[model samples]
Target: MICKVAILLVVASVVLASPYNPYYQQQPYAFKYGVQDSYSGQNFGRKEISDGNVVKGTYSVDLPDGRQQTVDYQADKYSGFQAKVSYTGQYH
Candidate 1:
């Protein structure tokens, strides 16, 4: 009886686990390609599209408190990526 209850509890825990959502934890100023057939957010630019791939562009995001952060994605992967964060004091 104890073993059966434990098995049922394990099954119920697995069923109540969080659903898998890829976009739920994505970076605010980061862009990735090839996840889907086309880009899904404003993080990418049309001009950056070249030869069926992303070449160069700037990705910007506004924080909850009106702060802006921008990052530039170059090449294919995360290589040569630069991020710029703006605050009332200065840009970093």
Candidate 2:
């Protein structure tokens, strides 16, 4: 099981080289992070926000027979990314 999520952006690249550049402005960010471990049984968490157009996030994990998996996500560079999944305990 490999789960890693990273979103970091920093670019100017000579004023973005004119794909309708118009002086290159798009920057907004918010962040949250979490982790929990009960002696090698790891838990997970995430939170996010952005205003470079639109972004939202939620993440969770704690599943290994006893369920606890959740994800809620949103994106808007004209509707490019989306996710919605959910689960909760007691499913042997």
Candidate 3:
């Protein structure tokens, strides 16, 4: 009987400590950055934010062909990352 009681208690604790538990949560964050140097022709930046369950961001880079490449992305716990890539400026 003691063995049965112990097993039941363990099972109850496991269920209580699952993802549904109030303490089982992730923190949210956000950030942005950039870089530009005319001397070296280096230019790139990124901005991102996460609300624990999903993440969203945008990043851009200076391309060698005189165009800028930008990417907007989103990702969720289950759906994986999705992005839209675009370019701007004249091509040489």
Candidate topping lDDT? 3
Arranged by TM-score with the best first, the candidates are 3, 2, 1
TM-score of each: 0.29, 0.41, 0.73
Q: Point out where model 3 deviates above 4 Å.
A: 1-24
Clashes of each: 0, 0, 0
Question: What is the per-residue lDDT of model 3 for residues 16-64, given as tens digits with 9 covering 90 to 100?
Answer: 7776657678789999999999999999999999999999999999999
Candidate-wise lDDT, in order: 0.48, 0.81, 0.95
RMSD list, candidates in order:
12.5, 17.3, 4.5
- Rank order (by lDDT, best first): 3, 2, 1
lDDT tens readout by residue for model 2, 1-92: 12222221123544455466666777989898888988989998999898887888999988888899989999986888999999988988
Q: Which is superior by lDDT, 1 or 3?
A: 3
lDDT of 3 at 52: 91
Clashing pairs in 3: none
Poorest stretch of ten by lDDT in candidate 2:
1-10
Clashing pairs in 1: none
Lowest summed lDDT across 10 adjacent residues in model 3 is found at 17-26
